[model samples]
Target: EGLRKAKSRLMEPLMQVDITTPEEYMGDILGDINGRRGMVGDLGERGNIKTISAQVPLANMFQYVSTLRSMSKGRANYSMKLANYDFVPPNVEEELKKGFVLETEED
Candidate 1:
């Protein structure tokens, strides 16, 4: 009852993602990150490899190893850690709520 009266928002975990890939694969990697609702933070370099830093939602990172391998032909590598929690966008929240089911026990 209290929850109904108060304002609330769905929150999701965001991850700080750091990727290292060859120059040739930079565009593909960046596109993929954008598709996952990621925000690119920095662009840097280490020797011949290019480095990308971005923040992406944890939900979109499942099975990312295979995707990265295919995109970069096993050349790119990435690591991620919990960055923070943020409120879900209205559209995404509505979609999530559609699949949610509530169960109650009979008294």
Candidate 2:
């Protein structure tokens, strides 16, 4: 009833994020992105920092700000905005299932 109606009407947008960090941290960053089921759309260089463009799920991105801060030791900065829906990979789905835990929002 209500759940079905909400699911049918609820909407969210995809965001494109660009991060700048040291070259040495590329693998670590990419690994984290992959683990989060994110897709690496592009990579480039700008001065001393490596620029990485990735498409990440909005639901999973909630904790990204803090995580990136800790991972880069304050050397990284990112910007994101709405994009479009894309298919999530099979492996990512499996990983999410394994990591999923049943918890109530109120709890």
lDDT of each residue in 9-91, candidate 2, tens digit only: 33335679888999888888899888776789999998888999998878778888898888888788889887787655566
User: Residue 93 of candidate 1: its Cα lDDT?
Assistant: 87
In the range 13-99, model 1's lDDT, one tens digit per residue, is 999999999999999999999999999999999999999999999999999999999999999999999999999989998777655
Deviation (Å) of 19 in candidate 2: 0.6
TM-score (all chains, Cα) for each model: 0.89, 0.69
Off by over 4 Å in 2: 1-12, 87-107
Native-to-model Cα distance after best TM-score fit, residue 1 in candidate 2, in Å: 8.8
Q: Candidate 1: minimum summed lDDT over ten consecutive residues — where?
A: 98-107
- For model 1, the local distance difference test gives 0.91
Question: Which residue pairs in candidate 2 have backbone atoms (N, alpha carbon, C) closer than 3 angstroms, thus clashing?
Answer: none
